[model samples]
Target: MINIWAIGMVIALIVTTIIVSIMGKRATANTADFYLAGRKVGFFTNASAICGDYFSAASFLGVAAAVYASGLDGAWFAAGFGAAFVPVVLFMASPIRRFGEYTIPDFLFARYGQSHRARIIGVVMVQLISIFYLAPQMVGAGTTWNVLVGQGLFGLSPYATGVWVVVLIMTLYVALGGMKGTTWNQLIQFWVLFTAMILVVIMGIVNGVGYSDSVAKNSEKPLLNPGKVTVAKLMEGEPGKRLYDVNQKNMTPEAFAKVQAVVDKGDPTAEVNILVPQKNKLHPERAMMFNEPGHRYSALDQFSMVLALVLGTAGLPHVMNRYYTNPSGKSARFTTVWVLGFVALFYMMSQYVGAIARQIIPPEVAKDPELMKLTVDGLLLKADQVMPVMGKIFAGEFGLGYVAAGAFAAMFSTIGGLLMASAASWGHDIYENYVNPHAEEWKRVLVGKIAVVGMATLSLLVGLGIPAAGLDKAYPALIAMMVTWAFSVSASAFVPTLLASIWWKKTTEKGALAGMFSGGFGAIFFIVMNILKETKAVAPDSFFATLGTLTFPVLITVPLSFAVIFIVSITDKKLPANVEQIWMRIHGTAAERRERRMQQMVLQPEQK
Candidate 1:
């Protein structure tokens, strides 16, 4: 019963991570090296690291899981994720690198009048996005551990055990290795996930699963989901026309008997799990189809979802912070280009992997006893599990090991970046500047390491708390869904203000503040309301209930944030005195020219 392959994979990952951290710790002696890899990462290496940072458990497990659950609607997660970098390349990348700072907060605070208030706000926004983004990766850690270990260590649940274990691993690596270490680990991790995905796709094709044909066939039937409904809910309506009757027609005798037993117990609250037909919110007149729109999102939500994702990539503090690590502004732009190709290919293969899961999973689930535990009448009980389950079906426990390792890699890589960003925002941006401006270099680096631990601990608690809050049960693909919320917040709060700072010289601190609060908090309000409604905590007739119904609020928040910035900036007209100089720093290549000259001098042969 012991999964030696899975355990071996985890051990290998742990050992490699520890070794890298030790080496990186030796190399890291100052704040610059700790926070931004001493601003020495090359274009391609930075791109690979960015890919690893950007593709969280959300991409590795959730994208495929979303596709498996919601059909065509889920495919948009990949499209939106890939398209996000285009705006980054065209708009934000050059400015972010050219401005030349260790973190996004540093750049924003410096750009907007050098106010302490602005720095504090930037720190809050960084925490909001990083924590939101960090939680799902932790969820992935717990879920992967559940599958690998099948039991908990000590007296804790398997999920809690996973959260504690993974957090320790991440804290040790990021704290000790710093950006220099994580960058190298991220580069290696990206390839591991990419290879795992490619192998799944190629192996599926070789196993005689026709990609397009299978999807076409899948679309022919209404999508079915595993559902758990109480006896009272299932028994509603007329006899033979109730939810129970509809469910019974598709259920096996063994499954039906279990349901009947629950009903016969006379407990209205007793629940039974069965396959249920999915409804299309976009088109209520039509049945949900695998190839058509509207299983996870409504008509308006489709646009909002895409908007958040595309704009959000440019706004992510952790991802944007990486631009500062680039050797040059031009190299930063080139990094975005490489990121586009790398992520696009990974998502394409992920979609293929998801599509093939539908063909491969159901047929194999009934035969494998271990696999049966993950399914309900052969359909996956949780969509986030699609990749690993498919991996096992293809190549047994060894395949599970491969995919599970990839899942952890995805989580560890992203969490490491988030921790670095969080640390820089706190230790570098807040502690070094305001709390202890005159602190020694060693003290500054020590603070960063401490911040890493603090953030990791916070993330662990959030991970453990998610299940207790029932947030994990509120969505079909919670990993992908939760990450989108983070994207929505980043897009609405940061993107407009960031754009104005770079292009609009008239942007006052007040205007930036207005935009940040209006967009950032607005997104948060809607997200919290949505979660409330989803968990059935909000009254159906309440005003908040209406707001909560939206799956994505970016359509309202993004434009509103931009509009607030424009109006406030025009009225305030309190630009920084050195506005022209700041603008030049963003667009000019003086830094690049100086660096080029220095490099040329270094390259010149010494006269003997």
Candidate 2:
């Protein structure tokens, strides 16, 4: 059970952390340095770091698991993730950097004419998104640890140990190095993930599992459809008990007639009546193709997911915070270009990895009939376990360690960024602005470090309860499903408000507040309803079901938020008189701002 290679990987990670800590210590002399890295990061470095921060366990493992389980639908998840950067580069990057603020809340306060209401709302949304986002990373950490170590320390479960280890490591890194250290660590983690994926793909090819052949083999069989329901009779003593013939709902008229004929001639004393698939012929003649839709989503769900991902990237605090580290607007724009390139390549490789995993690992039930009890439907016992299983299949024990190390790297980089973002919001936005307005620079840094520890501890406790909550089994790919909720909330709450603030001068403080509350609470409400329905606490045919069926809430919440803001802003007669000045500062070029500052300096001397 002991993995020597895994121990080596952990040692390597520790050594890298020490080196980055040393470098970060040199720069952590003040609040500005700790939070923004002195605003001196260049384009390529910042892009790489952003990739690390953005590609969480959701991207690294969940994408592969999704493809393995859902085929083309899973691939679309990766496509949406890669395509999200388009909107970020086209609309948000340069303008956000030009605003020149440390955090999103700072921008909100300034844009709304220094409104405390705007700042408080910004803090609430940021914390909500960050905390929700952090949970998946911790889940990923626990999953990887369960696979890699397969043992618990003392009385702790493997899952709990994994959560604690990752939380502790990330807390130390963020607390010591701040933004500068986290960025450097992220840069290194991204390459490690990229390289491991490439190696897996190469090994698969060398082992004679060509991409075309794997796709062909997988496409030959019918994809599993969870939505098609069938009816069966219950026994006398067993109330509400039913048996499911997964293929019965999808059968053609001819197939159904043949099945009915057999059922009609069979034993009449059977307790349950259902038509099952022929034991010898598991593959259906009419099956789903890899290029077709409806494998995992309806037309509405597909559009909703794509919309959330595309708009959500623009609103994520951890990703947007990286832009604030850039020296100028131009650097932020260039960094976005690099991020798109790197992320596209990563996603392309991940889809292929999923295909390869499916080809190499035969379902456990096929190998041992007894294992079916532990499996969902005799395919993958656990979808998240596919990556590590494939690693062991293609490269033995050492390969499992290498791939698991990459998985841990993915979690660490993402969690570090999330913790740093939370710290900035709590320490700078809330504590500094509200608690002690006259606090020194060193005191602010200490507060930020403390915030990082507090947030990490909270995330760890939440992660420890995830398995018991049955989240791991409810969704096909647990990390991706949870992450989609985070994205939906972020896109609905932040994207519309931020866009209006930048482009529409009529956006009043009251309008912004209404939009934020409507968008944030609306998404949360629907998400809770969905959970309730899933747990059977609410009836599927009830009113809550209508709101909960749609996995991505952005389709409803985003437009609703926009409408409220627009209506409220137009109705309110009060407007900030210096709106034009704030607009110029946000939209103006660097040269124009420099000239205005020089004029102010000269006029100040004359007035004195």
Candidate 3:
């Protein structure tokens, strides 16, 4: 255990406390200020904050862990995550701001006219994504607390004490800081995160060369390509039966659930299991991580992550929400460019460290204390710990402490953004806009704080269920898996509307409403079907895998949404008639530049 590391973490917590206090003093009573930083943040500040908000524990720890386990396939996740932002920069940022809306609901209501069903469905989807997303952050904080504290400090279980303490601090921080406080915290945390990753990556590469040299001298086969192994489907515990075949058909949740009950009741005839291989060259225990083909290959190469990162960024709720913090639409765009540079620099370092960990950490350690022998278990050790473990290995005690500090910083920064987003949706959008339109600035701020705390509490409860789901075994993969849900929902719902609202002339209120419902409910159905298959009733992999793995399968949802809006708008016979002029502003950089020139023209006389 690294005692000094634990002490450093305590110091970081104290620093957070102080920063929250300062932010509270500076925060205004206005709900807008609380939710959107009073619409006056600078480009650099907003950029850093956006990076902080965007890079959750998933990015910090999850990506590196993926690369460590799955080799090149894991790199796609990091690339995809980063690339998702590009669409935001090119298409969504300025136009969404030009619409001048506070939340997604507000944007929809304003664009389509008041529609209760649309707002309700959109809100529910936001809540689902926020809550589900929050769990992993809590899990991450808990994992970091447990791993670092257990090694460095004296007492307390990691699961109980770590999660509680981390949540409490995060809740307080967001409650007091609001958007302004969160922005500052995220900015500072981004630097720390970037620094830690760079240091670790450099150290990792240096160590990698040394390890490779040693392995080259000792090994019979090349380190990159070991030995082959074969596999065939066979039922476990019952020798004669073959596993339930997924390749033959698509099974839904209801059928899967029935199959599960039958199996539980001791079916007279049943077959279950997929016979995957382990590497013949490695220890028998080491072979468990491979798929049926004796290698780890992710099926998610359909969209180049770089393209997703570039396009998906425009549509992400939390990231897009930060645009409201900027004083104007142009500042938001500038901030995005900054985020790209910062994130790119930081991820390079983390990826290097992941490569290093693959070489250094003994595959045996993954299974030293578990039923799952070393490899599968090794590949998935609480994804949150991948970076920290690398920190511990590379720099020893100091590295561990640095990693712990970085982890907590990353957790709080992300939680601050999520809590603020959740608060904005509930407090500013719903409570003030609908429930009490006449509420005072101070009252609105107070309500937002309350909502923030309440949401954090709810998320904490869900966080407890995460470990119970037996997901703790492979925490990183779970975190990455959960991210797909957020992506699916956001990409399905927000992307189409954002594009139509910005570009299309024929888009009408009815079209917007239809698009919203299609995107929102469609995502929900897919997710529910996937979750329902957990009982092993239907084919375990069919519906759920299809729902999750094809995040960008626009063929199913996008066209349906686009068509609904098109047909409905034409039937309604009411389009924004000045849509061409409006699109000139929405799609072109000319208007923004012209606005800049006009501002300069006015300021010239004042300066003289």
Residue pairs in collision within model 2: none
**Considering TM-score, where higher is better, how would the candidates rank from best to worst?**
1, 2, 3
Off by over 4 Å in 1: 252-257, 260-267, 591-608
**lDDT, candidate 3, 151-180, per-residue tens:** 322354566566787778878787877787
TM-score, every prediction? 0.95, 0.87, 0.77
Error of 2 at 365 (Å): 10
Q: Give candidate 3 regions above 4 Å deviation.
A: 113-120, 151-157, 208-301, 304-312, 363-380, 473-476, 531-555, 576-608
Q: Write down the worst ten-residue block by lDDT for model 3.
A: 221-230
Local distance difference test values of all predictions, in order: 0.88, 0.79, 0.63
**Candidate 1 local lDDT, residue 567:** 96
**Model 1 lDDT, residue 427, Cα:** 93
lDDT of 1 by residue, 1-608 (tens): 55788789878987998898888997679888888888999999999999999999999999999989888888999899978899899989998888888777788788976877777888999999999899899899998888888789899998899899989999999999989999999988888888888878888988988769878978877888898898898899999868788768866776677778889999998888877789889889887889998997888888899888889988898899999899888999899999999988998888888887877887787688898888776778889988888878887889889888888889999999999999999899989998999999899999999999999999999999999989877899999999999999999889998998888888899999899989999999999998888887889778888889888889999999999999998998888887766777787788665665576588776632
Compare candidates 2 and 3 on lDDT and give the better one. Answer: 2
Candidate 1 lDDT score at position 447: 93
Per-candidate count of clashing residue pairs (backbone under 3 Å): 0, 0, 24
